[model samples]
Target: MACNGSYTVVIVPLQNSLYSSDALRFFHWLKKLRALEREKDSLWIGLQVLERTRFWYQHQLDQISQRNARVGTRELDEEEESWSCALRSSMQRVNGSLGSLLNNAYVCSAAPDEMDASDWCLRWTNAVLTQEVSQKNDRISILEFEKEILLQQRDGIHYF
Candidate 1:
């Protein structure tokens, strides 16, 4: 499976049963896909707006910084320079994280063309449940290991 821009593409071998059993059901599925596409486009537009706003705010900040630099003493200028460097670095990190989060938020499971909605849903649900159970088991194991270590420490202290 390959994915880009909030959509999943499933590549499967051609099969005899590739056609949908119910035309109306397929129509509804197509409608839902269109709705999702519109939502995705809206989200992209909102992100672009936010980017423009951020740029405008940064431009204003640069003007203020320049004004301060012109009036401030040498010592204050040095301090301000360092502070601005730190602030810019932090801002870049935050912006990078936000971009990553936004990109990742759109990813979702999608069914293959050959699979019906019900089968795809069931498969997805099972996969999620299996992952959850595995994680829970790992947590339980860690707790048990910690408990054993604590008990051993207590025994050693009593003997001492």
Candidate 2:
């Protein structure tokens, strides 16, 4: 009997699962916000880049979801594995470039339901675009900052 014979071992860390969930939530929220941003009353639409962006972001969301499903279910095909690995790497790389506060590990002070994590994630995304980050560099906080900017901007510009 060769001791080297492989034994099946499945290990799924809670953190990895949470991270994937966060990624999905973030992407989903981003999709909706992009839609809202294209209503001729939002910034991206005001810039006239919403159509191209909606297409681009839709593609990204699909890609990320597919990859996450494969990885989460351990059904990753060669192509899916490649894509999943690439997306994870890209996320990690982009994540590293961002302030740590913007990483996916942030915890909300209240329950996840108390505040919409999806919306929160969008805020960090906007902050990252603005090249700003919270003191701790948490991604959620970064998004919060972005949300603040948008609110202020909206309030300043909106006649109501």
Candidate 3:
């Protein structure tokens, strides 16, 4: 995420299941704001991102219900397992990042005079982005481990 030559925004890998084109556009817009040193604009965009994230979650849940109704309560096959894992990881990442943003917003609101507004906004945005990247990395590691376990299980079944 190199944005214009001013700064690099490290973002989490976009989960295909959750992030729509509009969401991605908003993220890029936020990055552009940061690049231009428009911290206030970035903060407002970040709040919109949070709202979009909530809607994404609700949409995902509704889709899941519809899928389950169509498929019944059968055990998930490998593809479904992979999709479910990715969805769960994305949901967790979104929740954690949103919570961090809300907490930072509260702290900033409670003591507006304690720090420069631009500085606070920049810091909060950076913190949220950092947490999202960390969570995505963790999810990747977990998914890799699960893959290894599944491969081993398949290999064992072949031998038996």
Please say which candidate is ahead in TM-score: 1 or 3. Answer: 3
Residues 19-120 of candidate 2 have per-residue lDDT tens digits of 597666765665554444333233333245446646766898997777677776676555445445545664575547544544543653322232455665
Best by TM-score: 3
> Considering summed lDDT, which 10 consecutive residues are worst modelled in model 3?
108-117
lDDT of 1 by residue, 1-160 (tens): 2125677554445434556556555656665675556446656766786889799778969987887787755445554565556556656865786789578765844323434555655765795698588669757765775676679779989999
What global local distance difference test value does model 3 have? 0.69
Candidates ranked, most accurate by TM-score first: 3, 1, 2
Q: Which clashing pairs does model 3 show?
A: none
Please say which candidate is ahead in TM-score: 1 or 2: 1
Each model's TM-score?
0.36, 0.22, 0.49
Q: What is the lDDT of residue 31 in candidate 3?
A: 53
Candidate 3 has what TM-score? 0.49
Model 1 pairs whose backbones collide: none
Per-residue C-alpha lDDT of model 3 across residues 64-157, encoded as one tens digit per residue: 8888897766766776677688769767876786688678875554323323546766777797798788779978877896898789889989
Candidate 2 wrongly placed segments (more than 4 Å): 1-58, 64-76, 100-160
Full-model lDDT, candidate 1: 0.63
